[model samples]
Target chain A: MEALFFEKLKEILEITDRELSANDKFKEYSEWDSLANLSVIAMIDEEFGVVIDNSEFKNIQTLGELMAEIKKRTK
Target chain B: MLLSTHHNISIKGLAVAVPSGRISVDSFYPSFGEDIVQKFSEMAGVKQITRSIDQQTASDLGYIAAKKLIIEKNIDTNEIGVLVFVSQKPDYRSPATAFVLQHRLGLGKEVICLDINLACSGFVYGLQTTLSLLKNSSKKKALLITADTSNKTLSPEDRTMIMLFGDSGSAVLLEKEDQGNAVFQFGLRSNGYKFKSIITPAGAFRNRDLPNKVEEWADGIKRSDYNTHMKGMDVFGFSITDVPNLIIDFLEATKTETSHYDVVALHQANIYILKQISRKVKIPFEKIPVSIDRYGNNSSNSIPLLLADHFEGKSQVLKILISGFGAGLSWACGSIAMDTKDILPIIITDDIYTQGDFKSSEHD
Candidate 1:
């Protein structure tokens, strides 16, 4: 599930050149833009069937946190 | 969430109007490269959008639509006992825009007037309010106008917004009839917590001192505080999650089935967003009437515009479900059944209230 999460993030954000790790701050990436952020949210809704709203999303700093938040919501 | 069904109300007439001026995606090729322009165009599902001219206000479009409906339907303006103007753009900050519309429409001095400041979700909100008020009042006929000139507040250089917003206004004439067509059910919710998700910081008194000087924003877009700033990601999350969930609940509460509706007219927030909502509720993509491709997202007017542009004032019974979401961090859904003839054809106008032209001499 964790591996799939990172995979979907990379695909949605269209990140190339650099690898995305669990600890990586996705916002710091050059590939990240407003569209990228929106795509990630949509990707999460499609892939995990849970929504992390804007306020909760602000506290999520890394790919690992994003995964954990989705997990928490599903549980 | 407020969920209730109102009876004895049928939309007697409907009309939507836009300015004759148009901004096509092809026109943006010079600012952004052709490749970028086309890519954005595909993403937004926008071919072109109508825009109001410098002298034309959102109210002008609303006035035109209302006037057209009255003239075409041969409505007795004296019978219109209430006027509800819902818009993010009003002629003045002082008098509610409804008063001005009332005067221009020649509605009686005793007409009830109101102005609601809201954006995208306003059509649903306005419909419910107009019907509820009319239900309790002595008069049975009322006019609901939802208009927005959101583009006027957007930064022209902001690619995120410039191509997405189109200005429009709509008028729905409602009357209580002994043999009304159908009941109107609405479910609404507001998340004031996310109010800042879409905002114009300096326009009002709180941030009155904020200058209009363009400054590099945190997102690297240069814009003044006066421009409407939208947190795209936040709103996207809300649109996908909160909006669709409420709509699903609304469907269940209203006992509306997939086959019940002839059309699912959604606020054209984003084509992808609309697709997500439809998928969640298991509504087919074909069932949704999409005007975004040609008209862009014209704020509160999306629902009426869809009816006007698609149905074109012909007589036929249709079951319609409409959902509008945005900007208050607000979302609402409503369903109604009515004859298509009441849904008048969309009109185009560049007319402005020339009497409103205010000029003050430097010496005065």
Candidate 2:
């Protein structure tokens, strides 16, 4: 699940896979704009059936945290 | 939510009038910069849109479409028993726009004219209302006009709204024909609690304290009570979830097979959101016609505008499923079938309100 999410995060953020660690702080990325946020939200909903609120997206800082939120909701 | 008319109310003719002023999405390059403009064009799916002139109002465009429908269909003014104008941007804040339209069109005194305030879901709601009124009544024909000059309500500097809305209007002739097909099977719902999700915060009475306060946000865009504001995520979430589910339920209630319909015309909101709904509903992408790329979101006029723009030239029998969701946080979905032979080409004009041709005037 972490690997899958890592790949999606890389694709959505337009970054190299090596740069996207599960513990990496995604909010620090310069490309973390509304489009990236919406794309991640859409990807999460489409792929995981987890509806991430915009506020939640803002609060989430790391890839691991986002995955944990998805897991928490999906479970 | 399902309502079916006992009397067959067929849409005999349909037409739309778009203002001559055109704004290409690419024109935003100087203001929004190339990257932001490109991203917005991709996100909003708006490539080009018709914009009404400063002097124009919703009534002006609606009148043009209505006049064209009346003339093209050869509809007698006296025979029209109902005139329903659906608009959120009516010309006057007090008197209903429909009454003004009735006088301008020179319809008889017996005609029942009403104005319904609605936005995105307006066409479906207006159609259902028109059909319900025509049912069991002595009236044989009704004229339904849906128009919106939503562009006028947007903040010029707001990133969220400026590029997303367009101005346009449509007129549909609904006649009770015994030979006509059953008009609509509808599902409509609203959540006023979420009304703030998409609204003009200050222009209305609720925000009378700050009716005209304009402030620049941190993003450097200036906005006031009069400008439209939207919480994109909320609107997007509601629409993508509810619209697709409502369409699925609507189809089931109407006993329609997914494969049987010819077109699934959802409101021209956003290409990404529409694609999301399409994927969720398992409907083919091609089946869902999109005009937002060309027309932006024309509010209430979207569906009829979609029809007049996309299906005007085709003569095939059209079995379509339409859903609209937006301001008022409202939604309406329905299945409708009609013959496209009566559909008229969309009229693009710069002509504003004119009593008659000056050259042909008897007084002249």
Indicate which candidate wins on lDDT: 1
Q: In lDDT terms, how accurate is model 1?
A: 0.86
Model 1: per-residue lDDT, tens digit, A6-39? 7788777666666778888888887776777777
> What's the distance in Å from true for residue B116, model 1?
1.1
lDDT per residue (tens digit) for residues B205-281 in model 1: 89988878998888777789999999887888788878888888998898778678998999998898989988898
CAPRI-style class, candidate 1:
medium
In Å, residue B196's CA in model 2 sits off its true spot by 0.3
Instruction: Give the CAPRI class of candidate 2.
Output: acceptable
Candidate 1's C-alpha runs over 4 A off are: A15-25, A59-61, B34-36, B361-364
Cα DockQ of the candidate 1 complex? 0.64
Error of 2 at B168 (Å): 0.8
RMSD of 1: 2.3
In angstroms, the error of model 1 at B209 is 1.9
lDDT of 2 by residue, B29-127 (tens): 887788887887887798988899977878888898999889988889988888999988887776798998998888888788899989999998998
lDDT of 2 by residue, A29-58 (tens): 887766676777888988898788766766
